[model samples]
Target: MSDKLTPEKRSWNMSRIKGMDTKIEVEVRKYLFSKGYRFRKNDKRYPGKPDIVLPKYHVAIFVHGCFWHRHEGCKDATTPKTRTEFWLEKFDKNVKNDQIKQEKLKEMGWKVIVIWECELKKDFQRIMDRLEQEFKK
Candidate 1:
């Protein structure tokens, strides 16, 4: 299938897509704050610059968009029909980078947590509850 928007328009739209401080990231931050958990947002010291870092618990949280991170078995992880090869390669790189970053963080003695966008939309409370439990461990 062809792209509906003009090349320029598509470029603009893609440019507007944020890398940090995204809506989902904000929501997760708010939840943690409300629960009295303090955290650092996108600390450059960490690999991948995790969305939320709770130094107190030595935990790093990544709130990932299923599409961008290529969440396996997720419907949102659909590929763009216009650039199948390009998108696939880009997504593959993202997945590999994520794994590398998470492994590095783990080796540094930090507990890593990945929160999918779909999980937040489907069950915000449940995901937050699980996050709290991780802190307790």
Candidate 2:
């Protein structure tokens, strides 16, 4: 199917999408800070520039949007009807990169945590509790 928006409009919309300091990322950061969990945001020294880095716990957290990160079985992970192949390839690359980056972090002895956007929407409190437990461990 063809795109509903004009090409120029679509490009403009895509350009407006933020790559860093997204809404979900900020929310997680605020929660961690309020709980006294000191962290660095998008530390460039890390493999994937993790959204949150807890140096004390040696942990790296990635706040991923379900659609962009291609969260498996997630309702929000629908592909665009237009340019199906391009979107598929992009999603595949994102998933692969995530795995590679997480693996590298683990090899460096850092605990990696991925927080999906949908999970935060569905059960924010539960996810935060689990995150706290990870730090405690």
Model 1: which residue pairs collide?
A: none
Write the residue-wise lDDT of candidate 2 on 65-115 in tens digits.
Answer: 999999889999999998899999999999999999999999999999999
> Residue by residue across 1-137, what tens digits does model 1's lDDT show?
68899999999999999999999999999999998999999999999999999999999999999999998999999999987899999999999999999999999999999999999999999999999999999
Q: Against the true structure, what is each candidate's TM-score?
A: 0.98, 0.98
Q: Where is model 2 more than 4 Å wrong at Cα?
A: none
lDDT of 1: 0.96
The TM-score, computed over Cα atoms with residue i paired to residue i, of candidate 2 is: 0.98
Query: Would you give me the overall lDDT of model 2?
Result: 0.96
